[model samples]
Target: MSRAFRIQVSEGVQRIVHVEDGVQGTIDVLPILAPERMAELLATELEKRGYTRTDQDGELVLVKVGEGNVTVEVNVRTGTVTVSIAEEVQVNVSTTASGTAENIEDARKQAEDRAMRQLEAAVVPLQEAARREATARLEAELAEVRPELDAVVNAATAEALVEKARELGDIESIEGSAEDGNLTIKVRV
Candidate 1:
């Protein structure tokens, strides 16, 4: 048997960019925070501190990343992040049937296999939790740098706006959109 888990990090570039720009720009540019890059950075950071990156089917599992022993699981397509600590689980099996000793032994093995499967299932959620923790930490750090990013973007936009105003006579209108922390400003002619 097999099991799967995911923790989604929905495209947050929209919100983050908006927050940075302070609602004074009209370009809909997506910030570059690709899921793969994020995963790789996280894994590398963890590995630097003696953490292991494991390949589990299609997920990137971080066995440890940073000051603590934490596991993170990432879903490539869906961009889900899960964080949790992994713990070993024991499986027990018992059989009561009047048959060949070999048959009973086989039954015990089957039971043990079932128990092992159960253990894996239980461990998956812990990985999901770890992913969440890693993601949270990343977001918090990103937030601090947002204003600086916004200033750079805004300065360039201002330069472009000056050039446009010179060419287009005068700005007729301005509009802003703020969603999920993303900011966009549009100049109307």
Candidate 2:
């Protein structure tokens, strides 16, 4: 192998910020699913909040973060929700990167320090309110999922029970009716 005498110098800053917001509440979830409608409503809310629609898989919603092309994930769960963004934005810079060696020694040294500071500055400010923004947006959107689940279940179950009473073999005659979710069953054996 031929003798190699060379130097390489590179400078840059990589800024990555991970922002997540989580909140818990007793939001009611209905067992029945109209997922397509649900997703449409949810995606609408996310779009309103500055998230660009990218792709969706099953129950997961993915959006592109505006400033840095970061990936944001929204998870909709029963009684809970979480939004998160994890991405890296690069602000690194290269100095005289030529000849390498003694020539870049001074510039590279200075740039390295500046790059570090810039990275820190760019990401720290986002941390202060990113989570809050996510939380607030999610909270507002979560209202759509709220429904009178308990009332619906109670009414349906009651009506079903009345219908079942008519099937009892011991009953000679039966009358069962439901109105306004109120069930009336009369059986004569």
On TM-score, the candidate that comes out on top is 2
lDDT of 1 by residue, 75-150 (tens): 3223344443333323232222221223555545555555555555554555455455555654553454345334
TM-score on alpha carbons, each prediction: 0.32, 0.36
- In model 1, what lDDT does residue 93 have? 29
User: 187, model 2: CA deviation in Å?
Assistant: 5.7
* TM accuracy, model 1: 0.32
Clash counts for all predictions: 24, 3
Clashes of 2: 3
